[model samples]
Target: MTSPRFVIIGAGLAGAKTAESLRAKGFNGQVTIVGDEEQLPYERPPLSKDYLVGNAARDSLYVHDAEWYSDQRVELRTGIRATRIDRTSRRVELSDGAGLGYDKLLLATGASPRLLPDTAGVHYLRRIEDSDRLKRLFTTAASLIVVGGGWIGLEAAAAARQAGLAATVVEALELPLLPALGRDVATVFADLHRQHGVDLRLGIQVEHVGNDGQGTRVRLADGSVLEADAVVAGIGAVPNTGLAEACGLRVDNGVVVDANLRTSDPDIFAAGDVASVYHPLLGRHLRVEHWASALKQPAAAAASMLDKDEAYDELPYFYTDQYDLGMEFLGTIDGHDRVVFRGDLPGREFIAFWLKNNRVRAGMNVNIWDVTGPIKALIRAGRPVHPDRLADPGIPLDQVATA
Candidate 1:
């Protein structure tokens, strides 16, 4: 009998890691990875932070060395797109008029940045090329106008400030990251950027973006205009679910998957930004588009494909580095009512917790290192705690769980 064949779509971190996990788990069958990008599989976080600012080397972005695939007997098919999935025949149709039969399949198609309505003179930060273009613009540009005050926009603004460029951020919301971090915590970011000399235009919309003879021009809803050498739009991202939807694999906001990362079809699985996984702890489906999910979900997907059946119930995790502030957030604030902070909020060194009915739901550590384990423990504890004890700096995090 022929050995079982495994095929993975998308060649980002999740796809690369899934292939690595499969080999580690002793899947000696034929393995193939299909990606549309010409470059090797790489991580996306640095594209906005270190790589964007020229602090990180380009070679550092790749997941593994170029020779790793050949050494492991894994077929790395870059610059090829997976156009369709033939479920009945268990094959994947390629853009180059080729097909690969698979006993099991994994989709880690990731996501693309949402473009501005008028993208004539707008830039986005999703791929390496995008960051390279921004880096080149920063070297010569005198000013930058960033649209959408989300993480990507904020990080790019911070990079622009670092490059000595005048930066302005425009957001429709009252505060940046309001929906994700809530008002109290989001205020900290608003202040952080303002203190760094970023001209933030909040609760406002961009009327239009176009290029003039001098440079890029931005028209605001308030009948105001601003010109800059470049403009970047980091509004949000949409999952790459066209292949999944075409194959009828059940797609909601993304490809819906069970606790084990197994999609509607038993033979197909999904991970990374494209998978809306059911969280056992939250008791609902949560789709996370963060580095942590992309880095960690592949292991569970590999195990599920091998019939190991271990649930991927890890709490959502993400972190950011902007200017001098470094933060790590764990869990989600889905239904939290209030936030409690420990440490110095004014000094930007603190740990904030989101609680629902006195039970910890999420936590964020700002410039506070070596506390992620404790924060994760508190969220997983799922028990009520005294607000006073949680707020007290003298009390240990582990002890605060019962206090």
Candidate 2:
């Protein structure tokens, strides 16, 4: 009998980690990674912050050095796209007319940045190439018009501000990050940017955009025009599930997977932004698009592929940085009743805890360091906490949580 060969599609963090996990678990089978991008798998969060600000070197972005791949004996097929998956034959067809057979398949195709209607000089920050282009643009571009108030948009605006370029942020909602962070918490970010001289326009939509003599012209729904040297749309991202959908796999928002990260077909699995996986803690299908999920899911998925009966049940976590503000959020904000503050909100150094039924459902640390462990503990404890103790900075979270 021969060992099964594992073939993974997409060469991002999830895909790279999948190969490493498979080997770490003592899987002596062949491992291959196929990716459309030419470069090796690399970290993405820094692309918006350090890389954009010219503080990090390009080599620092990669998940591993060139020698590691060869040392691990993992075959990397770069600059090649996987066109289709033939389930019955258990093989994947690539754009280069090559087909690779696999006993098990993992899809970590990730996601693509959502784009607006065609407009000249409009950019999106997603890939290394996108960052490289924007880096060049920032060298001489005087002003930037950023659409959407999401993390990416805010991060881009922060980078632009750091570069001494004028930045204007346009959000359709009443406040920035309204959908994700809610009103009370989003206000913190809104104030952070405004304090740094960001021209934030809220409660408006971009009706049309076109090239103008100034560089780019944007028309708002309320009949106003704003000109800038460049325009960037960080609205959102669409999961790359074309191959999964075309192959008759169950896809709802993303490739639907069970607790074990197995797709509709038992032989196929998915992770990262492309998978809507069942989370035991949440008791629901959650698709997280953060670097944390991408870095964590692959190990669980790889273990499951080897019939270890493991589950990817970790709580979803994400972090962001803007100007001087840095934040780390743990768990989901769904069904949270009210937010309780532990420190000084005015001082911009506090921890926000979202409570439901007097129990902590989620919590975020803004500009606070060395407190994530306690925050996660409180969330997992799931015991009712006194509001006064939770709000009082003198009462440590460890004491407030009922262990």
Which lDDT values do the candidates have, in the order given?
0.95, 0.93
Tens digits of lDDT, candidate 1, 191-214: 999999999999999999989757
4-56, model 2: which lDDT tens digit per residue? 89999999999999999999999888999999999999999988899998999
The ten-residue window of minimal lDDT in model 2 covers 394-403
Q: What is the C-alpha RMSD of each candidate to the true structure, in Å?
A: 0.9, 1.2
In model 1, where is the ten-residue run with the lowest total lDDT? 394-403
TM-scores of the candidates in the order shown: 0.99, 0.98
How good is model 2 by TM-score?
A: 0.98
Q: Which pairs clash inside model 2?
A: none
